[model samples]
Target: ILSDETDPNRLHDLKDTLDRYQVYDSAQIDELVGLYLSGADRDQLDPILDACVAAYNVGLDEDGQVDFKGKAKAFARTYAFVASILP
Candidate 1:
């Protein structure tokens, strides 16, 4: 599923999101999707997620606006529905 990336500029923002602004902000879900577009030797999803989990702005509390588990479940449902419709 690899394709030549036409958006190198956006990929460059990954480090800033993770390092520079993590104390005050969380990386957007769409920003994380950039990992696939990065074409790096190994996907850094696990480490990135772990880092995000540790980030102060991610707010894992029950009333938090950012919900990693909820996002995962939503992705699962969307993927399942799309796959079911595809074939």
Candidate 2:
């Protein structure tokens, strides 16, 4: 899904999935943004920033905490996955 989704509609679907699963948190989203911004070049940063914002826009809870317990672990795993792929 990640590799094939190159447009806003597909990305929005992915964000909806994350929201439905309640599998990520604000802090995790912030960390993802930080990771992308830290290493991405100017050209690569835009999409990463957009993805981060979209993910957070859908996934963050009203209280600003993770919606589901233990989902932070999933966020950590996702972070590691992205980190490994990044330069």
Candidate 3:
């Protein structure tokens, strides 16, 4: 995720990937970019992101476990609102 990366450019790259994959809408991507650029600590965002993954995982049976798509969707849905309001 963008939070773990040191380079800001990687966040932009991720936004591109998200848009290209249709994982999130334009508004969600804007929120994500704002969050990353807001100087919030990665430590703060990590657990929230992790929780999104875990919540999504609960819907999956033991045989199937995947993080990328589900996690991204969850993150966008959950975090986007908060990110939009942040300075």
Candidate 4:
């Protein structure tokens, strides 16, 4: 409300309120970043993202499918070794 130019009375004397500073944890953002890299599917991550959006009141982009990509690259050096190791 402090940023709102129209609401001048929204600000209250800090003395009347708590005298301590509050710190918010970043676990939610950290989890989201980690989960995104762990090959989690949309169905599993949507709920988490929804909760984040609600709490932060901001828009977030849903992660794309892991199986799809905008461009393809050839890693010929390790392809044979990796493909052979996997069942």
**Which is the winner by TM-score between candidate 2 and candidate 4?**
4
Model 1, global lDDT:
0.48
lDDT of each: 0.48, 0.55, 0.53, 0.39
User: Best to worst by TM-score, what's the order?
Assistant: 1, 4, 3, 2
- What ranges in model 1 sit over 4 Å off? 1-31, 43-47, 55-58, 62-71
Residue 66 shift from truth in candidate 4, angstroms: 31
lDDT accuracy of residue 26 in candidate 2: 68
Per-residue lDDT of candidate 2, residues 1-87 (tens digit):
235433434434445555665444566667668768689565655655576566566766655444433344444555555667668
| lDDT at position 15, candidate 2 | 51
Please give, for residues 1-87, the per-residue lDDT of candidate 4 as tens digits. Answer: 222343222222221121111111257557766788998788877877677445333322232211111111122223344456558
Error of 1 at 22 (Å): 11
Judged by whole-model lDDT over C-alpha atoms, candidate 2 comes out at 0.55
lDDT of 1 by residue, 1-87 (tens): 013433333334433433443333345455557875786434566666566667644544553434444444444554455466556
Residue pair clashes in candidate 2? none
Model 3 stretches with alpha carbons more than 4 Å out:
1-33, 62-87
Worst 10 residues of 3 by lDDT: 2-11
